[model samples]
Target: MLDNAKYDQINPPSRLLMGPGPINADPRVLRAMASQLVGQYDPAMTGYMNEVMALYRGVFKTENPWTLLVDGTSRAGIEAVLLSVIRPGDKVLVPVFGRFGHLLCEIARRCRAEVHIIEAPWGEVFSPDQIEDAVKRVRPRVLLTVQGDTSTTMLQPLEQLGEICRRYDALFYTDATASLGGNALESDAWGLDAVSAGLQKCLGGPSGSAPVTLSARCEAVIRSRKCVEEGIRTAEHRDGDDEMIYSNYFDLGMIMDYWGPERLNHHTEATSMLFAARECARLLLEEGLDAAIERHKLHGGAMLAGIDAMGLEVFGDRRHRMNNVLGVVIPTGLDGEQVRQMMLNDFAIEIGTSFGPLKGKIWRIGTMGYNARKDCVMQTLSALEGVLNRLGFAGPRGAGLQAAWDHYQREQPS
Candidate 1:
């Protein structure tokens, strides 16, 4: 047995997070989390919860009445929806483009659903026809996929897939953790039956809370699995005839009751996380969702121009890439990890590495949420130039920063 050691106060060095996600939380969102807590059922607390639901509907660009927060990270929202709606042996079709698509299949399998998969090469996305062909063959009860898979820096085109799912009578579900807020995702217009996302990305908050919205059809499927708790039962012979949702904690039906007008309790709300999520949506709406997406596009275009000027190859198909992140191919003869280390240790910056196939071959740079700004872009490009030069990876000295500057200048109104 080892003795416990004393630790210092919770101060950590400042970092410019230009990695895949969990970017720096906005100052306003941090302040929101620092506010005092109240009882779970306090009138003010429920009122705040209701306000959050309404705010996320605006963020999601949906009028779905079932929008609410899940008290865990992004995956919690994904699992809650999948588990609540999928009975054992139900079929789920997952199209794999990157790591997160595999994650969806694993989660569905755990729900004891029959998981089917189709794969696209990494650094690319699926065509709606390809997915439609699979749906025609399998006829899955759900067509589940990711909107943006950061592992390959690709955003799947979801617009037409919704119509395909509707034609096949399959529920269209997506985990938008990497694409929401700073990207265009129209829930109702896209015919997305269920949508889930975390505050850690373009919404500009810390991780731990997930915001979700459900179309009316998706809500009905979950409602059919409701099993009220023994203690809270008023006059229940059990509401739904279908098998009860397996996991008590992730039961979306029960979570709905908690967030619904009845004001029932599933568990104590994750109060601080709720505050962070609320402020995240508030900040995005304050800026206007379309405007926020445009901001990401502007900064992302600058970053892309800078990377190209630096003579580095981007990993994915540029036409389908996400606006907030990119995968930069690491040139041969230099260690990618060493370059990342120097950027972190010396310049106080952080970038990410690719996963699976692209691992050790590319550097994933991000400009998302609070860190997506002109200064952050210029500083990161400049510092990267210095790091590459020091590592003996020869490139034009100041071209990257100059390219980024020129791009930004062109975008500014005359």
Candidate 2:
């Protein structure tokens, strides 16, 4: 502790974040977080909380009353939902399409659930027919899937699966952290029981807070599992059975009571992060959901065209690609890490590498939120082309930039 006492004066490189997450946050969000902090239970703070809930209601495209911010990252929201809703021996069905699906199964297993997996190969999504058959056979209590799996750049179709889950009397849940602000997702219309997201991806904010919404059904289930904790012990005959809550901190039952009208004390709220989350949702809602989705589509389309013009093969089925991210196969004779490192250190750009079976085989480029603008797209493509050219990949000069410009031109009126 005594050595190296002085902190290094440093400034982070100004990077064009073109990765799967932690994309550049909207400047408005930064300003909001920088605003004066208030006490956790300050009236102003609570008012901000209420406003955040209303704002994210629009972000999720849901009328669900249980929408709010969880006090951690996206994965915390995922675990909160699972730990709250699932009891021991409950049968949970997870459909594996990418790394996140495996994460869901792993979390559910930790909850002591009998987890069943319906899987498709990586870089593909599960068909409705396959899911229907699995749901019918498994008779699971909950059917969970990731709306967008960034690792594979695939969007799982949910329009029909919601009806399937309803018919089977199983709750449907999804983690939309990677897709919410960039794609069209209707939580209420899609019959989603619960959904969770984070601001690090398409929402254009920091990753400390998680935005979550739970349907009335999901809320009711969590409320039913409420337990009296030792900190708030009472002397009403003192004969209650102290059944163990799965996780005290993540207990949605207790959390709901804390956040609901009763306003019981729980952990101190992450006030700054909550402010940031609220502003992120406010920005999206002000922009309009359809417009945000369209922006993502336009920029993502430009990215695809740019990558194609570079003479590199794009991975995954074209018909099912996610609107904000693209997975491109690493060209032959070029080191993927070298390209990624060059983009980061040399050009101040950040793109993603693949995971699991797709690792070292593909590079994931994202066009999302603040980074989905035309300039960002063009700059990324331009830098990428230069990097690729330096590595001996042959392509038409300035082809990627030209293709992206052409796509943008096509979007303009005659």
Q: How many Å off is the CA of 382 in candidate 1? A: 0.9
lDDT of 1 at 222: 87
User: How many residue pairs clash in all the candidates, one count each?
Assistant: 0, 0
lDDT by residue (tens digit), candidate 1, 144-242: 989999999899999999899999999999999999987899999999999999999888899899899999999989887756455354344344323
TM-score of candidate 1 to 2 decimals: 0.96
Please identify model 2 stretches exceeding 4 Å from their true place. 1-6, 228-244
Query: Which residue pairs come into collision in candidate 2?
Result: none
Tens digit per residue, CA lDDT, model 2, 247-318: 778888777777777788888889889889988888888888899999999999999998998888999988
lDDT of 1 at 119: 98
Minimal lDDT window, size 10, model 1: 233-242
Each prediction's TM-score versus the true structure = 0.96, 0.95
